[model samples]
Target: MDLAAEVAALTDEFSGVVRVDRAGSTVLDAAFGLADRRHGVPMTVGSQVAMASGNKGMTALAAMSLVEDGTLSLGTTARSLLGDDLPLVADDVTVEHLLAHRSGIGDYLDEDVESDIDDYALRVPMQELATTEQFVTVLDGFPTKFPAGERFSYCNSGFMVLALLAERASGTGFHDLVDERVLRPAGMLDSGFLRSDDLPGTAAVGYVRMDGHWRTNVFHLPVRGNGDGGLYTTTADMHRFWVALFAGAIVSPETVALMTTPRSDVPAEGQRYGLGFWVHASRDVLGLSGYDAGVSFRSFHDPVERLTATVAGTTSAGAWPIARLLEERLVTTSPAA
Candidate 1:
């Protein structure tokens, strides 16, 4: 089967960028449709797209660095570092709980409970949320959903607090610290916490399909993303990041091992929650996926084949099919055991 062709066929259905790689070789690197339909811009391999909640992995990596340095432990109480700033967090919630999405704090943007992301954006202007401290109000209003370590609930607010903890413990701005320590070290030169209004060149403007046309998503997201999301990056850069992460270039092997370790059970069938990555086991691969407004992504590492596959999309719902196609092809093309 021609996997690339199959993925290409779906591009007009879901306008965005798609890239795939294996063992340092470009297996499929293609872009289709418009990145900026208004301006008629096409997404290139270098075009940066907002990964939305996909940025969680970088936040988790920042937290793990503190863990490696003995500044904080995974089991350290969340309240201890964040103090009165997050009075609503349960007493039992720990750093690990946030990392693993097991902290039962209320998600600020609960799509299941709330119908519209734009409605929540109205309560607080997206432009005001530029720093970790700015997000405190969002978490403070939501009560604990359950006791810490009870279950995996996919809490974005939990990660927001984690970013605050990193700032408090490291005595550095969360965005700056992550950039200096994590992005730079991982060789992710194009990734950063760009303000929603001032996105860099080569960055794809996120769009929502409305009335058979695409509208820019600047007003639909927080002005700046915290630990939960808001980093812009390219597919090639993300591939470099995954390679560095697995090879332990950005953190120790011991640290990466800990991040990859399943910490809590996901209610989603056949899935487990790690520090920041999602682990899905089917037959030949375990993977991570993230989706949010105007962004979709999936990446997998096949231990049996010693291969990796990644898909990054500017639209909200195109990554899985592309990643799946690549995965099926790679597994079939793998050398005999």
Candidate 2:
């Protein structure tokens, strides 16, 4: 089957970029639809798009770097870093729990319980949440849902706390720390946490369908991203991130192993939760995915096959169809029984 041709045929149905690479060789690279409808700018291979929650892996790597430098440990309590500011959060919730999604803390933007992404509203105005410290106000008022080391719960608030911890321990801004300790080492020069309100010309404008009309997502998300989500990157840069990660450039091999090791089951998603990456145990694939009002992304690396696939979309649900098509092709072409 001509997978590339098939993907190309579906261009009109999706809006984004798709890239597949095997053994360091490009297999498929294509872009579709308008990046900025108002300006008539088409999506390009170099166009940067938001990765919603997809950036959690980078945040995890930043924290691990601090661990390597002896500044923080996985067992460090969230309370120690945050102090009495957020009294509802339990004192037993440790860094490890947050990384593995086992903290069971009340999520400010809970995905599991919230069926429709559009129905969920932010308590704090999006513009006010420009920094990690500013997010604490909205993160308050929610009590801990369960014990610290309990079962996994995908909590966006937990990761915001992680961003706070990273800043406190490293004495650096969360964005700068990730750029220095993660993106620079991983050769992802084009990737960073960018403010949605003021974006560069190369950045894609996220769109969502509302009342049969397309609208921008500027008001749906925070003005700036925290640790939990919101990083702008290109498809090539994302592929570079995967390659560098597997090559042990961003984090130590031992640390990567620890981070990617499956620690809890995410039954609803039919996957397992690792430190910050999603694990497909049978296929030995590790990945990061995200979905917001007008952003969608999926990127995965198959270590056994030395393959990497990425799909980044500019609309709410545009990336999934293309990603599933690529997954189908991968399964059919797999060497394993």
Best by lDDT: 2
Listed in order, each prediction's TM-score against the native is 0.91, 0.97
Q: Cα lDDT of all candidates, in order?
A: 0.76, 0.87
Model 2 C-alpha lDDT per residue in residues 20-46, reported as the tens digit of each score? 988879998888988898889988888
lDDT for model 2 comes to 0.87
- On TM-score, the candidate that comes out on top is 2
Task: For model 1, state the Cα shift of residue 274 in Å.
Answer: 1.3
- Quick one: RMSD of model 1? 2.4
